[model samples]
Target: MAKVLVIAGDFVEDYELMVPFQALQAMGHEVLAVCPDKSAGDKIKTAIHDFEGDQTYSEKPGHAFTLNASFADVSESQFDALVIPGGRAPEYLRLNPAVIDMVCAFAASAKPIAAICHGAQLLAAAKIIEGKKVSAYPACAPEVKLAGGDYADIAVDDAITDGNLVTAPAWPAHPAWLKQFNELLNK
Candidate 1:
């Protein structure tokens, strides 16, 4: 079984974070959830982003998710794969140098990386997606392109995998995203 590391932060999309964390565990993988500056037993608030006939997704308060590991203790070599959930959190997480370095380490090693929606922000900040085809929330297309990655304008419920990276536009693509990621981990 793969030891998966999930990097998340406050306001991470509720479904994007919770679903994969739980589903992967259910699939017999050892999963560890962490947030920068937070330790095990700490909780991070989540936000639900739903497409409610508006120009963009609408946000609502979501459940408080507990951290199972401390970011300070995270070492890239300790895990086999990385998962980054999207939401407002990525906007701030991308500004942390340590977070950027961590993502780069995972990419450099060719570890399986699954990023959804705004999660592309972190990948772009890490500058690891160059020449790759990445899918993220439509609004993040510019950042993906600026980072030298080809933006995959996929459907919200679709996912795409390139090399060691598996990406999707949003939580709606969880099934496809997680499935592709799981396959990468097994490889």
Candidate 2:
């Protein structure tokens, strides 16, 4: 079974974090969820971002996600793949030096990385998206462009895989995103 590392923080998209974490575990993979400056057993408040016929997504309080591992204890060599969930957390996580470095490490190692929605912010901040094809929430197009990545504004239900990186616009694309990541890990 593949050992996966999930990076998340306060306000991480509810389904984006929980779905993949549980689904992967159900598939016989061992997943360790973590957050910067947080230790094992620590919990981070998550938010539900759902489209409610509005111009944008609506946010609501979600479950408190518990970390099963410490961010500081993670090593690129210890995991088979990485998962980055979206939401308000990425906005600040992308600014964290440790988070940026860890992301860069994963990219440098060419490990399978699955990022959804605003999670692309960390890829952009890590400067690893250059010349890569990526997809993310529409609002992240500018960031992808600025990062030298070719932003594919595909449907929210679809996922795009470029090399070892898998990206999707939002949680709505969970099926595709997780499937692609699963294939990559199995490779």
Best by TM-score: 1
Q: After superposition, which runs of candidate 1 have C-alpha atoms over 4 Å from their true positions?
A: none
Model 1 worst lDDT run, 10 consecutive residues: 96-105
Q: Pairs clashing in candidate 1?
A: none
- On lDDT, the leading prediction is 1
| Per-model lDDT | 0.97, 0.95
Judged by whole-model lDDT over C-alpha atoms, candidate 1 comes out at 0.97
Task: Name the lDDT value of residue 53 in candidate 1.
Answer: 98
lDDT of 2 at 39: 99
Model 2 lDDT, residue 136, Cα? 97
* RMSD after CA superposition, every candidate: 0.5, 0.7
51-152 per-residue lDDT for model 2 (tens digits): 999999999999999899999998889999999999999999998998898899999999999999999999999999999999999999999999999999
TM-score, cand. 1: 0.99
Candidate 1, 16-117: lDDT as tens digits: 999999999999999999999999999999999999999999999999999999999998999999999999999999999999989999999999999999
